[model samples]
Target: MILEAVVLQVKKGMEAEYEKAFRGASKIISSMNGYISHELQRCMEVEGKYLLLVQWETLEDHTVGFRQSTEYQEWKKRLHHFYDPFPTVEHFEKVYTLES
Candidate 1:
């Protein structure tokens, strides 16, 4: 499995609108191939910062499958404008876990 992470900095005063848009756009990603789960975490210290985490079966599932699909166009249309400087998304693999 792989994890996709992005630090989103929403444009000033658009936080509420961004969240609303994200909720509506979530379906687009959740339905993609190899999608496991995802979460959008708001930063406590920062007024317009958020962390988006998505789990996929493989990196290509996101980089190729999702990003290249037409659904991505919809996703971008729904959420991209809310961002200030566009977020840089990164991928990761679990190095260790302490789950019980």
Candidate 2:
């Protein structure tokens, strides 16, 4: 599986609006091909900061399948404006895991 991660910083005073928009945008991504799951995590220590993690069956599932699709445009419209510097997204593959 491919893991996509991004650290987002929303514009001041726009956190609530951004979260609401993100909720609306989640459906768009979840319906895409190869989508496994995703989470939107808020940072308690830092206001307006968020961590977005998404799992995909393969890198192409996100870099091509989703980013190239028309649905991505809607996703961008819903969430992009809230970012101040614009988050940089990175992908990774699992190397190890431990569970009880």
Candidate 3:
């Protein structure tokens, strides 16, 4: 599995709007090919910050397939404006799991 992690720094006063938009946007991503599951986490230490952790079957499924798809365009439209500065997204592979 490939893990895609996105840390969003939302503009002040945009948290509610961002959450609503993200709820809508999540559906688009969840329907895509190779999409496994995802979680959206709000930061308690810092307001207006969120962490998105998504799982895909492979890196190509997210980097190439999803980003190149029309759904991603919709995703961008729904959620991009809420960011103060664009968030940096990174991908990872499961090296070790303690819970398993």
Candidate 4:
């Protein structure tokens, strides 16, 4: 699995609106090919901070498939304006894990 992580810094006072927009945007991403799941988590210690974690079957499923698709345009229209300086998205692969 591929993990796509984004740390979003929303503009002050725009958090509520951002969250609302993200709700709609989530539908766009979750429907994409190779999409496993996703989560939008709010930061308790910092105002207007959020973490967006998305799981994909492969890296290209996001970097090439989703990012290049027309759906991504809609996603950007819904959520991009809320960001103060834009978020940096990073991808990762499983290295180690422990479970009982």
Candidate 5:
């Protein structure tokens, strides 16, 4: 699977709004092709930082299929304004894992 990792640095006091927007945005992404799962994590040391991990079948499914779709526009509109500075998103592939 392909993993898209998005690190969000929200503006101070915007964390709740960011999470609310993300919950709505997640629904849009979930409907897209090749979507497998999503997980949202918060940084303990940094109060306004979050990590969004999304699993997909392929990179194209995100870069092309989802980003080019109208849903992405809405997603951007809903969530983009909450960031203090735009987040950096990167992709990765599973290399190794240890089961719990």
Candidate 6:
């Protein structure tokens, strides 16, 4: 599995709007090919900061499949504007996991 991680710095006073827009945008992503799951986490210590983590079956599914498709345009339209500086996306593969 591939983990796509991004730190989103939402613009000031836009958290509520961003969340609402993200709710609608979530559907777009979940329907895409290779989409496993995703989670959006809010930072308590820092206002307007969010961590977005998405799991894909493969890296290409996100870098090429999703980003190249028309659906991504809609994703961008719905959510990109709220970022002050465009967020940088990074991908990773699991190394280890510990669970009780």
- Model 6, residue 43: what's the lDDT? 97
Q: Each model's TM-score?
A: 0.98, 0.98, 0.96, 0.97, 0.94, 0.98
Report RMSD for candidate 2.
0.5
Candidate that would win on lDDT: 6
Flag the better candidate by TM-score, 1 or 3.
1
Model 4: per-residue Cα lDDT over 29-72, one tens digit each: 99999999999999999999999999999999999999999999
Instruction: In candidate 1, list every pair of residues with a backbone clash.
Output: none
- Residues 1-100, candidate 5, lDDT per residue (tens digit)? 9999999999999899889888978899999999999999999999999999999999999999999999999999999998878988899999999999
Q: Which 10-residue window of candidate 6 scores lowest in summed lDDT?
A: 79-88
Provide the lowest-lDDT 10-residue window in model 4: 17-26
Q: In model 4, which runs have C-alpha deviations exceeding 4 angstroms?
A: none
TM-score of 5: 0.94
Candidate 1 lDDT for residue 17:
90
Tens digits of lDDT, candidate 3, 73-95: 99998999999789999999999
Writing each residue's lDDT as its tens digit, candidate 6 over 1-100 gives 9999999999999999999999999999999999999999999999999999999999999999999999999999999999989999999999999999
| Per-residue lDDT over 1-100 for candidate 2, one digit per residue giving the tens place of the 0 to 100 score | 9999999999999999999999999999999999999999999999999999999999999999999999999999899999999899999999999988
lDDT of 1 by residue, 1-100 (tens): 9999999999999999999999999999999999999999999999999999999999999999999999999999999999889999999999999988
Clash pairs detected, candidate 2: none
Off by over 4 Å in 6: none
In candidate 4, the residue pairs with backbone N, CA or C atoms under 3 Å apart (3 or more residues apart, or in different chains) clash, namely none
Candidate 1 Cα lDDT to native: 0.97
